[model samples]
Target: YYQEEFAIRRTLISCLDWCDILRIWDVDALL
Candidate 1:
């Protein structure tokens, strides 16, 4: 259970990081 929880947290953080990066890219494209 602990391992699974840790994996999920890592995945969530990674996904959030990707989202931030994509948002930056999208803004750059618009400008």
Candidate 2:
């Protein structure tokens, strides 16, 4: 159970990074 929970947290962090990258790309395009 602990390992599964850790994996889920890592996946969530990865998605957050992707979201940040997308936001930055959008801002760059706007500029």
Candidate 3:
């Protein structure tokens, strides 16, 4: 269970980072 939680946390971080990058690109395009 500990390992599963660690994996989930890592995945969430990666997803958040990807989302941030996408948002930045979208804003740049709008500007």
User: By TM-score, who's the top model here?
Assistant: 2
**TM-score for candidate 2, residues paired by index:** 0.94
TM-score of each: 0.92, 0.94, 0.86
lDDT of 2 by residue, 1-31 (tens): 9999999999999999999999999999999
- C-alpha root-mean-square deviation, candidate 1: 0.4
Residue 17 miss distance in model 2 (angstroms): 0.4
As a whole number from 0 to 100, the lDDT of residue 22 in candidate 2 is: 100
Candidate 3 structure quality by residue, lDDT tens digits, 1-31: 9999999999999999999999999999999
TM-score of 3: 0.86
Output the worst ten-in-a-row residue range by lDDT, candidate 1.
1-10
Residues 1-31, model 1: lDDT tens digits: 9999999999999999999999999999999
How does each model score on lDDT?
1.00, 1.00, 1.00
The regions of model 1 sitting more than 4 angstroms off are none
RMSD of each: 0.4, 0.3, 0.6
RMSD of 3: 0.6
